[model samples]
Target: MLGRTPLDAPERQQEVFAAVLGVLAEVGYARFNMDLVAGRARASKASLYQRWPSKARLITDALKANLPELPQPDEGTFAEDVRQILLAWGEPTPFDTAGIFLGLLEGSRQDADLACLREEHVDRAYTEHLRVAVDRAKARGELPERLDADFLITALISTFVLRSEEQGVIEGIVDGLLRPLIGTFRAK
Candidate 1:
């Protein structure tokens, strides 16, 4: 959060994040060097590095910024909360997350630092985001307390892991499969 000091306002931080995401989406992670993002943001590499300790952190922050803040549920049903969480996978556009998932798993196998970030940042963000929705459901008495929301969250996201390459998942396959599992939590 402290990395984006370039602009005076929250919106300016968004501008920086957008520039970085453009580069990442266009160039992919390998070629998206700090200099390129700095050039786009019209800031120095020192500024970028000062804000984010590494390229991975920079990208992660950029991705985090681009997303709307976690959904706060007012919907009366667990089904709606679960749907919102599942629908995040289809938002904007879908990418081949399977490849990225495998790459992170394998890349972390060789690089301890990368593994640590993967474990702490990327993985945590996903789980915690899902947990927010799940927790809201529980508070509303929509989900039984016995359900392990953590495991269900993992399973929900996992539905898209292996098949993100197919591109048809966005249509409904993901939500279709996961809804049945999460639907059980709906308030009767």
Candidate 2:
């Protein structure tokens, strides 16, 4: 029987999560396994399995742990709030976020568990903050009464995720794209 030493320590768990991401970036979700994570983390496979029974569970937890802390700023104006959110979201991470997103996208296609986890943990993380911002805007009469919040949120998130790498992209998305789009939907 293997000891649960890695699971016992928070630092050790963080190391394991980093190892999981490293393995995921290298081999991707389809080929990711406990053995590879254990090898990278220097932990026992039994210990990892003891903590996270399924690949989906482990990967989802790892991704969640690694996600940047999103800011929830209530700037006076909706536009300013969105600008703050996008700038924070566009901040670079220590790891390859795009690679992880691609791996998750591929994994979610094949694993129902992963898909559900992605929706619950990953998607909600981004959408929930945006939802709150949108709600505040609606309350302030900044958005049209008939505006589709979900569609708008999706567009903003998709734009940030796709074009975050480019310099000044967030500013352009906010001022050039979103501001005009929101203007079109603003109460006349």
* TM-scores of the candidates in the order shown: 0.56, 0.87
The best candidate by TM-score is: 2
**CA lDDT of each prediction against the hidden true structure:** 0.64, 0.83
List candidate 2 stretches off by more than 4 Å: 1-5
Model 2 lDDT per residue over 1-188, tens place: 23446476888888889988888777789999999998888888888888899999999998898777889999977788889988777776766666677788889999999999989988998888889899998898888767899998988887777666778877887789767867887735
Collision pairs in model 1? 3-51
Q: Output the lDDT of residue 84, model 2.
A: 90
lDDT of 1 by residue, 1-188 (tens): 53445464677667777777677666655566789987887777787788788877776666565543455454555566555655665555333355455545554666577667766767776677668777777787766788788777767677666655556664454356545654654635
TM-score result, candidate 1: 0.56
